[model samples]
Target: MRITTKGQVTIPEEIREAAGFGPGTEVDFVIGDDGLVRVIPSDRLRGERAASLQGAISRLRGSADVALPTDEIMALTRE
Candidate 1:
């Protein structure tokens, strides 16, 4: 498969299905000393398994909240 002018290449359907990759799924790339590239599920990239939203919220319960100005929040949202 060739990369388009935008430097985008379409992942083949068979590969995507086999890897369980779908819309919104994330992946990571690793380069070995031997110059081999490996594609890994994003969850394994940071040595973290995906957690539910509830778990994430629970983990943040004790974190201090920093209030941001409305304009800053809006700018961040746009990004």
Candidate 2:
């Protein structure tokens, strides 16, 4: 396959389908010392679905008996 002047090449349809590449799917490019390039799916970085943190801190609400320093509490609140 040849890269056009725009630095783009049409990935063969068969290869794309077999690799499950699709619109909006993220991929990575790795270059070996031998000048070989490989395409890998980004999902490999995430082992599994992640849990939502929306309610993870719900338990901390109204649980503080002692007051913390304003600066320290503000730092934690930012996250």
Candidate 3:
């Protein structure tokens, strides 16, 4: 696909879906030792960071491990 004057080329819908590139996904382009350019999704790293810090977050909530039903979890998020 052609890149616009803004240097933005549209990533295909299939590629986007496969890479989980939803709105506001941060990405980086890196050149590997093999001289191949790779696209890395930084947003996923953010998620990884959050997951790694889950224990700290839980601690803030008094380390409660109450298991809520899936529906209840969904309901709270929906609100």
Best by TM-score: 1
Model 2 residue 3 lDDT score? 91
Collision pairs in model 3: none
What lDDT does the true structure give each of the candidates? 0.82, 0.77, 0.84
Q: Indicate whether candidate 2 or candidate 3 has the larger lDDT.
A: 3
Pairwise TM-score winner, candidates 2 and 3: 3
Q: Indicate the TM-score of model 2.
A: 0.49
C-alpha lDDT (0 to 100) for residue 57 of candidate 2:
61
Better of 1 and 3 by lDDT: 3
TM-score of each: 0.51, 0.49, 0.49
Error of 3 at 37 (Å): 1.3
lDDT per residue as tens, model 1, 53-75: 56798998978588889999899
lDDT of 2 by residue, 1-79 (tens): 9999998888898999999999887877778799999887877534322333435567667888988899999999998
Flag the better candidate by lDDT, 1 or 2. 1
TM-score of 3: 0.49
Model 1 worst lDDT run, 10 consecutive residues:
45-54
Alpha-carbon runs more than 4 Å astray in model 2: 45-79
Rank all candidate structures by their lDDT, best first, as comma-separated numbers.
3, 1, 2
